[model samples]
Target: MASEEVVDLEHQNHNFHFENGPAAAIFSKATLPVTLKFKDVIYKIKIEKPGKFVKAAGKSEERTILKGISGVVSPGEILAMLGPSGSGKTTLLTALGGRLGGRLAGSVSYNGRPFSNAMKRNTGFVTQDDVLYPHLTVTETLVYTALLRLPRVLSKAEKTAHAEAVIAQLGLTRCRNSIIGGPLLRGISGGERKRVSIGQEMLINPSLLFLDEPTSGLDSTTAQRIVSTLWELANGARTVVMTIHQPSSRLFYMFHKVLLLSDGNPLYFGKGSAAVDYFSSVGFSPAVAMNPADLLLDLANGVSTGENGEDQAAVKQTLVAAYKTHLSEIVESELTDCSAEPPVAGDDRTLSRWSNTWVNQFSVLFRRGIKERKHESFAGIKVAQVLIVAIVAGLLWWQSSTSHLQDQVGLMFFYSAFWGFYPLFQAIFTFPQERLMLEKERASGMYRLSSYFMALTVGDLPMEMVLPTMFYTITYWMAGLKPTAGHFFWGLLGLLYGVLCAQGLGLAIGAAVMNLKSATVFASVIMLTFQLASGFFVQNVPIFIRWIKYISISQYTFKILVAAQYKVGETYPCGGGGGEVCLVEDFPAIKPVGLRGVSTAIGAMAVMIVGYRLIAYLALTRVGALKK
Candidate 1:
């Protein structure tokens, strides 16, 4: 190790502790460092087979993902799993991290005991994909993470300072203000973004960290740098386990230990630098000088033939048999050596899924939601869309009097329809887009599902009203429906209520289906059905399917908007003279929606708003796999 770099890291660590004492102290080192051990860990799940391929269309088959894999990794060491694609490397990593839920056989333990909440609190799992908000700056990303993951003992200022320290520690000081942009949004490089993800886990300074393919898409230099960072972190009183897919020689040699898997079978579990020698001793050496990682992957794929003139299948069997005959006993001996655990100190509150209280979570998440969604809510295009629609509608029905009942009523219905479809489509993408990020954060036990859901719903509330309020103010008076405040505000409330209800349905559909394409299609179909049955297009339907209108949120919306403008006994000018004719029950837009049910319709829309959001919340709870 270079003295200069080590000195810089030490200085950074000292400065972090000095500047962020409260936040850093909350994540004090564990009493005993974690030692992960797994034995006979087998995982299988059922898959349905087609009738053409099996006896029945729905016949189930058990597919084994992990085949009794066993190994141990102690604290302050790097255990890297290496294999080709579909070799159960990720499966074993996930299982060892205690994040995989299934009919998992055998046992996985931390510090010689079963996986517990205490282990969970101290563990960090970084998935293969970098899940982050593209719009947030590097500083903002880590601050939010620290706020959520760090316990309540830390103040907001301390958390912020701690985030800055992490950024500096990760060498992200120059790019701290840069946004973590996505494919379309130009921002930091892939390597910096990967560090930000690691920084998120590093906020609480976990004792046990697991990363899946941290360097899957980097150049050899960047991959080496990333591995070196992990190596440094592991050496600092932490246990690091990660899955690597075909790493460079420099990157591969940094690992203290390596486990090679082939089709759910463990081919070898030993030192990384020793792997080439072990495979050579087993008669599968490369033809010339080769990267050890490459050779290990070749052996895992059974690409090399044996001295016995074996084919690929025979070669695979030989490797698996050889591991069981030689290295399996060695792994078992290591597991047996440190099987006893010392009791650790912690409480239920500390082990709880959420680090912060509900109020704290709601506050932080609500603020974050506002920060993340403000651009979407107030984007020029979105505002311009509403402004253009309002201006056009005002021009179309400009200064129309009660005499032109059809035009006035049509204008009112336009308000209902636009707000209905607008908010519906806008809110439908909310959950689908955030599904991956949401799952990542929730699985890490950052905050409760209720906190996130509530924050999202409320954070978007003020922005949700902006365009509608603007639209109503322009069209209500410009169209000459009513100059009175009572009528304008009542009609505005109805439209806004409808907007919220439609938004709820959008959220529900998005959460339930979770695929953007499929959710959009489903929402389109459901909304089209709601519009058709909204009593505007078809009022006289058969009795058999008449109940659909009762559930159509758009129908109640249309009714409320219509009732706010139209009165039962209102009179209109019949001619140029002072003669007048009263609007009857059969007036064009008045017939389907009566003026008498405005209050009841408002109540019904309120119920629908609550009901739809409730459904969305429940669907999300299931998706998050909420335990607490």
Candidate 2:
């Protein structure tokens, strides 16, 4: 028991106060004021998935994932943190990256200042998954990103030259023009893609760079090469910090400083070569285990099959003893002394550049939306659907039916309504597929929500107008629905209006729901409600149900279509003189007339469009693309 107490004391060396003058002096110099500083920073985390319900469930039972995680990487030093799986390494990396929120107690200072949102802009984070535009070639992708992101920052020649230089430095020139093939053949190799991601971050030349698992999943040789490449990249006056798993012996020498973590504890953090020796000095004998890496790993985990409590206790004791011995020597040497004064308060408060911030943000978003829509195809399925509609309308036009004018009006409403929803269905599945990329861009400040919204509205014009025009042109002529220029113009306007409204509603629903199934269900319900409320096949249902018609944009759209197709008394009811029969010659004309009903219909559609857009923007800014 006495020996066990000694072992506990040895392990508790890291838990010390600055009561001693020498100790205070050593600690004062330990964390120098720099762009990035973490002073004896301890990050304790409760292990649980992120969300409201799960967070609540594990609120009391949460286990600490990261504990006493403290380190510093100044402006010119690259800190390579090494840790075993489940050591909360990723959590620590993410905390520094500003991706997670928690009851954080540690101080993460930037520029010798406490952390702030502006620091986020100055830091570039590269996750395991490299986010790139798969459709664009390497050069095209980088150039496009540069054009949008660095528009006012550089001139045309300078931008191109900068992108080329970045590409050349990253060894991507050989494959610069090659397509970045992906899951569906959007071309590039995994290594190339990874470098591209790095290049993307470098384009901004952020003051600090943070990467998670930069060498993961590659073969030993490939991993070594990648690590060497990164070492070369970090040669300048730039700070690069990355979390790596079990690195090969060859790659170990590439790191300038190493942070070794085990079971939420910092086992060793300093120069790489002294790692094994430091452990040995603590009472751990390397003779028992030839591999220093394996020994350090086992010592960190604190649990091994061949080792009992005493055996593990000795290892822990050795680590503590070595740390204390090192700390004592550093303090006794009196390398440096701090002034006898309180430290100044850091500038951690974030400052927002309110003026014209939206303008730049919107421009970036608009460009991204335009580029995304440009690469997408609208020829195949849309053309086929339009052809099918034309054929069916032609067949219906030839059939012997009563009230030609009424039939024409019904056909016009059906065609307009169908055309309006095609864009919605197409985007329903597509938006979810690109959700991850959307989040990546959004988080990186690539664009603003309003800008993307406007760009999407404008960029979709080609397909939006073409598809509806084809449907209306075919149906109007084939179904004999008054082929005058006036009729065609109003009919087309009503159809496009419905289509745009549907597009807005679909985007809103898609953005709101995390799961594809839930989004589809919501869209289906909305579509059904609107279609039913539309006064198409049946006019008067019941008062309560009929009231829904006033709110339905589709109903008003159909009203416009009806007025455009048939003049008053041009076609009577099948019963000839019912209450529904037209008695007023000055009927509502889809074409201006007195501009009252037309204005009302247009106004209703405008309100619907804006309302759905507002809902979509709120969903995007608040919910984002994160799953529960």
Candidate 3:
């Protein structure tokens, strides 16, 4: 599907024209030729992998991951990324892929265009993990993606046809219907899934592709086959850029170009065969017949302080010089006396991306959420927990009567308090897992965070309703309160409020804490403290803890209960005998007196929901916090 130009990079005016078939096909109604350029780029990471403090003592010690990295891969060229273990290879790939989370520094341009939304549209990235939906068949996965991304330009049938073509091109026919397996199943070989990952990018037919350790976790032979397939992919006019650790001789031979990254630095970036020769000329020759990849890697890692170190340093100096030379040439060529014409302003519709059809984006998202819940076993657990709560509430009901108003109020408070914390806790439990998936999808522009939040709320509605229904149904009927349906419904509202508030609160907690262990601790302490301060069944809150009543979600929900159910006409504290029209008139406005007494309860819930979501968004955008 054709996308609205997001960015139009004007490097330098070139009157180059392609009349031949391939060129004609690419530039169907072409006007000008633009070149993508990459200038001096560098990335670094702080060494905070734990125990480093003791190792470095009071002295400030730092470690570099990828240093002074720079490269430029134009359209129709494959830049093979190579490095060894701990050589900052993955770091470089991730930075280039725009997933470093924070620890990345570089300007990546396309056709001399900066890496903005428009440029990203023309680029496809294949991470090591085949992150396709596991349940969907290979064709189904790509077809769904195509339908979503290419709907404006392709009909359903056309989408399917496009997916099929990509499938054939990537040699996925043999296992097109098979599942892309994970830790549990072995549906296809590692190589096939890798191909599928690549094929996903092929669907976009992007002008540029970046891959991260694509061949890792696979057999040497399988890795080689995958690289060979990738070579074929690049042959079709895509600029395939991938980071690979140690390739076989044959695999190395297939590379059109290679970029060597070591210790967060670019050691080399040029032709594949020439890389070996380059290292050899600088006195870092391969051991007679050792793999060139291994030799370059050793040369990159062999830096030290003495004579041998000096030799390694000398070799590195040569490689660095070559990197600087290539980087300077590319930049110099792209930006020289560049006076480009004004760009054409065409389609610009960000909100039009919204899916408003019957098979709307929300509908699809809701379905995905439901599927996710079912897969995660949330539905069954919700039912089970509701049933258990119902049984327990029934027992509590069987023990009391409506005459015990104070005790009943206490019971309601306890239930409301429990409900409030339940959602928060569930969020802590479930949101973390979803956070990982969310990051991946968000990076790929799957949908907006609002869409995700909406889907989650909608998808979990049934399950969320179940628990509140169980709680309210059992408690309302057994307490033997007013028999009116209005009363019953209000009772339900009070219960559901607890649940919603909890959901928001839980999400907030998840966002604030980066790791599960820390999140768990934070959730535990906060929930416990809130429950205590909620005045669940306790009459007196410590003077010091009085403020919690204002902040506790349970306090507001319980107050809402009082405001919704209490009969002001019946009684109050008017300084008379038992029933001398004891009244302070109608109940105080739903303020400091009743459900509104929650003071900041609603605000707290809002803060939790919005604050956590913002934090999660920021965290997801971060590139290197994963290590932490």
* Model 3, position 269: C-alpha lDDT score: 71
RMSD of each: 5.7, 11.7, 7.6
- Rank list by TM-score: 1, 2, 3
Alpha-carbon shift of residue 219 in model 3 (angstroms) = 2.4
Tens-digit lDDT track of model 1 for 83-163:
889999898988998878889999988766677766676788888899998888999999999889876655688778788
Estimated TM-score for each candidate:
0.92, 0.78, 0.72
lDDT of 2 at 183: 79
Evaluated with TM-score, which candidate comes out highest? 1
Q: Which should have the higher TM-score, number 2 or number 3?
A: 2
Error of model 2, residue 627, in angstroms: 17
lDDT score for residue 437 of model 1: 87
What number of backbone clashes does candidate 3 have, counting pairs of residues 3 or more apart or in separate chains?
A: 16
CA lDDT, every prediction? 0.82, 0.62, 0.61
Error of 3 at 35 (Å): 5.9
